[model samples]
Target chain A: MALLKIRNLTVRFATSTGSFTAVDGIDTEVDRGEVLAIVGESGSGKSVSMLAVMGLLPDTATITADEMSYDGHDLLHMTKAERRQLIGREITMIFQEPIASLNPSFTVGFQIEEVLRLNLGMSRRDAHARALELFRQVGIPLPEEKLTSYPHQMSGGQCQRVMIAMAIASKPRLLIADEPTTALDVTIQKQILDLLMDLQEEYGMALILITHDMGVVAETADRVVVQYQGKKMEEADVLSLFEAPKHPYTRALLSALPENATGDRLPTVSDFFGEAVR
Target chain B: MSVVLEGRNITQDYHIGGGLFGASKTVQALKGVSFSVEKGKTLAIVGESGSGKSTLARIIALIDAPSGGDLLIEGQPVNIALKRPDPVLRSKVQMVFQNPYGSLNPRQKIGSVLMEPLVINRPAIAAEERRALAEAMLVRVGLGPEHFNRFPHMFSGGQRQRIAIARALMLNPSLLVLDEPVSALDLSVQAQVLNLLADLQEEFGLTYVFVSHDLSVVRYIADDVMVISQGLAVEQGKREAVFANPTDAYTRQLFAATPVTDVEAIRARVAKRQAAREAAGAPR
Candidate 1:
């Protein structure tokens, strides 16, 4: 059985003007130890679907699904406490902006230790030791000193490492990384991606990487799901998807890559679907 | 072949942490870098964070004076450290920053935002003329005159970037220093903006000093490339030469680390795997 299964998932947010459908009905499933990549632009609902799965969306958001399950447990039927207990331990997520996601007021060490203690019921000393261990595992230099430093004191890469440490502290069965390397430089992005893949292998965790970067998807993902404006455009194994994209939107996106350009101008998505799509 | 902007051994140093009695520390952000941008050509400065690429951009744009070395704009020596720069000379070079949202004024209308440069630098121009130029600039950048009354908050990120580009062109600058101009945008919008930039450069015969960390974007836009690492230029040559065969170890490492999306290569690998599976008679 798949580790996660969702069918007909939809997410809508209430706004001052009207209701906004962020995620249209989409079905998704992830097997154990598999790497699935969700590729999309900014408003394509890639992040929103995962946020809905983690139950992290605000009250303004209304999420509905026909079937949503994790490890034989029904996610839709679970109570708030039960869902909370399942999410942070079994299924963890890291956001794009690590520095902004972390609490500015608290030390990173305290934050991770609190998660270890509350989620795993670890003793104080044990939580401290585990926090250090997680930090070291995430390749943070001088874990002892970084524990004392606030989020503001560290660089963007270091803050992301801290976020990864916090996410993997409880040894999650599935990890969701949303644009993990987007905020980093190319070299730093390479390092972070390698580290994430390494940790995913070590823990035997299913990884769901959500990014708009085709290069990253090509390099890391086994299977790919392309989203466009709250709709799933296409899905296939990574190589097949890249070699022969079925959807026009997918073809347009692949052509828009600077490396694939044959002329001075890059063909945009609108060029494929027309200006009406925009 | 005329050099529009030339930097000879440009250097920038920042003094840090000596508020009251303790000795200050001098950090060299740019360590004597030299380069030149030809007329109607794009020179890309590629580097990682804290690699001093942005410092070079600022120096080229005349926003900050270098601690040492000469900057010649159209063969005229410019040393802001020695004396004040002429307004005309300053107006010859314009800059477009990375984040369009943060760079634009939320309270100001788009029309006013476009005309602010002219109001400050070319005050002798009439208000009516400034308004005409701003609207025309807007149209040139793919935005319509109907967007004149709207605020920055009313526009999307792509439109906001168009407005930013239009504003930079108002003064008719010969050189534009774009510091990661499209990095904050989405991929599709990034391509659009890059196309717009290419069109505008052709229409105006503008020279560009583009500072970006993304090698792929640089490869697309840059005629000449300068790879900076740790405040030094590791390699500098034509874009094709540098990209095809980089001599510097740091440049090689950067190229190796950057993920390339080559469909043919991936297809070949996939075919090989399938062949292996077939040889083993694996079940489908």
Candidate 2:
């Protein structure tokens, strides 16, 4: 069964000149206990599409979707109250920058526990215990000490782990990771990916992994959806999509990556993708 | 055999905490780190944050003073005299920061930013000459001269980066300290930037001290690489020698975690994973 379904979704930002569609007619689905990666470049609209489904767009932004249902709930039509209750509880998200997602004023423990108290209806003591448990689960050293420490005290990798802990703390049916490892170092990135895979397997949750990295998608994702200017160019199992990318964009992207070899000139972005969209 | 820039056992210490007596704590940023870059070549320093790679670049760029050890520019030790020495070494070395958007002044036109350096250092080059130089540099970086009037904010992230590169090369520096220059861009855009850097190096005889977190980018552009971990040089050698035959355990771990360079191998691995996923996705 599909945990989250997005059909013909589009997001428009209202500018003084004119409204522009950031995400255009993107369609995708995430089944239970599956990893679906949305791969694209900077302006490819992968982030906008997921943000639209999350009901996180600002007042100036408008969203249009044929259907966006999460766990039989109409996400697109959800009231503000309904969406607030659902977010961070039923469909949690882990952003690329963890420290930014967390509140600087509050103790890391307080923020994590706050969600549990509100969503899980747990006592303060129990919520704090759960937060600590989550920290340990995400491989953060000294969970108790880390809980009391502020987000500023922790490293980027540690803060990201805290986010993962908070994200999985609720045991949401679906998790959306938006370039979770992009800001981290390669080794830490690998570790974070491994941690996410472990958590997903344990919780049996659906995952929407949005990233610009093809290597990351291949390593973790079960399926890949290649996006170009908010359009789905190709959808296949990670292996097939990588091994035999049918889309010219995907093929060109693969060829453009720098390699550790001799006499191989790196292909320019315009070499494959048309000169300039504008 | 001529070393353009060389740092000999450089150690930078920071004194933190302040009070009545200014209680100081010694924090060593670089511990006896030494490396050299040659003319018309690229040497990449690969590390994560706080790896002291940026500190190394700063020490080489003369942006920061080293607490210990010597920095030599073309065999002359960097000192007070050499530093403000009448635009000699200033014209020889330049730095391009990681955040191209933040690096360039948003208010200034692209041409003015390029002209700023030349006007300061090469006043002998007149107004018309400066304009021509700016246009030529912009063209070299793949941006058209029509953008001379445009601000940095008008361009895409990649184009802004091109402007930054143009600014760095405006003074015709012999050595460029590229600190995570392409790490901010999308992989596709990064590829284009990487290709451009390689071309620029050959054309202008520019030596690059490229610092990056991505091993692949380092592998792509660097002729030599030094892996620094926690203020220490763990591994250093020719690109092929270090990657293909890494001596240090940390370097090996990094390589293993990173995707292998060979596309055929990566494809094969992806094929296996996809087949398994397809089978699992099927009715079972």
Candidate 3:
């Protein structure tokens, strides 16, 4: 059975000038233990759709859908208390910037333990023990010492590992990582990616990985959904998407990358649009 | 080919955690970094974050002085640490940063922003002529005249970066130091900006010292490549030589970690998977 499903999902923001439709009607699904990558440039509504799923969008934004559900639960009509119960326990999210997302005032141990105490209803002693174990599971060095350190004391990569540890504390059935490694260096990015894959397999959790890098999609994704200007351009398995992209926009994005660039001039989407016009 | 910019054994040390009670320790950011860029050629410095690539760029651009080493521009030696670089040397080298929005002034119109550099550097040129040159430069970066009066907030990230490029080129510097200029743009826009940079480099005969974390971009744009790891230049050679046979372990690891899209191999794998699925009677 599909772990998560969305149909005709639409998101619109009330701007000063007028209403702006940020995400058009789009349909996607995530199977149990499968990795679904949402790939697109900025302002393409890749992040917006996922934000809508997590109920994280601001009040100004209006979200609607024909059908949106997770594991036989109707996500579109969940009550606030029910969502609060489900979010961190069954579904969790990790953002791109780890330092900004983590609270500066709180120690890493306190934060992870807080999640455990609130979501899982554990005692302080048990939560502290579990937090240490979680840190070790995330491959953080000197887990005990790191627990006492604040977000600012750790490096960017270590902070990201803490964020991962927090997200997986409850052993969520579904994890949504939005550009989880975009701010990290390439080598560190590989480490984080490997860690995520290992955890996903160990927990059998479905993952929704959002990013703009094709290289990341090639390396980690099982399936891909490409977005452009708030519209879905293509959706296929990773191999098929890379091998035979039907959309011209996807092809242009693939070709625009410097990896395959051999000629003096690269092929841009505007060139394709111009040719289409002609 | 004359050496437009040369650095011999450059070093930078940064002091950290100094307070009223605690003693400060010096962290060596760069150690004995040396390289030279020929006139009308691009030399790329590639490294991960905290590898001291930005420190090297600042030393070359004269934004920050190196703790040790000599800098030569156009065969003239200059002391970058103790004294201000001569106006001639200052005007000869300009820098374009990564963040387009933060680098530009949000309050000023794009036209005035481009004209300010010309007005300050070449005061003898009349206002009308300066406006003409600024407008010409605007067009040269692929922006239109209609965009001149708009503020930086009105433009997209890619467009703002183009404006930044225009501002950097206003002084007609012989050398440009671009630090991760296209890392923020979308893939298609990155291509457009890179192509524009290539065209401008040829037209102006500009020497470039490009610093980036992305090796593929370095491969495409750089004539020579230098790999920096932990404040040391591990490898330096022609682009083809370095990429073809990387001697450094860090360089080889960077190459392996970089994910390159190979459509043909993916297609064959997909075909094999389809065949196996068919044999198993699996649903599509």
lDDT of 2 at B99: 94
Predicted candidate 1 versus true structure: per-residue lDDT over A160-254, tens digit per residue:
99999988987899999999999998888998998998887678789999999998987788789999999888999999898899888899889
Candidate 3: fraction of native contacts reproduced: 0.70
TM-scores for all candidates: the values are: 0.95, 0.94, 0.96
Q: Deviation in angstroms for B61 in model 3?
A: 0.7
Candidates sorted by DockQ, best first: 1, 3, 2
Candidate 3, CAPRI quality class derived from DockQ: medium
DockQ of each: 0.67, 0.57, 0.59
True contacts kept of each: 0.74, 0.61, 0.70
Can you tell me which runs of candidate 2 are displaced by over 4 Å?
A260-263, A274-278, B80-85, B260-284
2 against 3, candidate with superior lDDT: 3
Please tell me the interface RMSD, in Å, for model 2.
Answer: 2.7
Clashing pairs in model 1, backbone N/Cα/C closer than 3 A: none
Model 1, docking class: medium
Residue A138 displacement (Å), model 1: 2.0
lDDT of every predicted structure (CA atoms) = 0.91, 0.85, 0.91
TM-score of candidate 2 relative to the true fold: 0.94
List of clashing residue pairs for candidate 3: none
Positional deviation of residue A177's Cα in model 1 after best superposition, in angstroms: 0.6
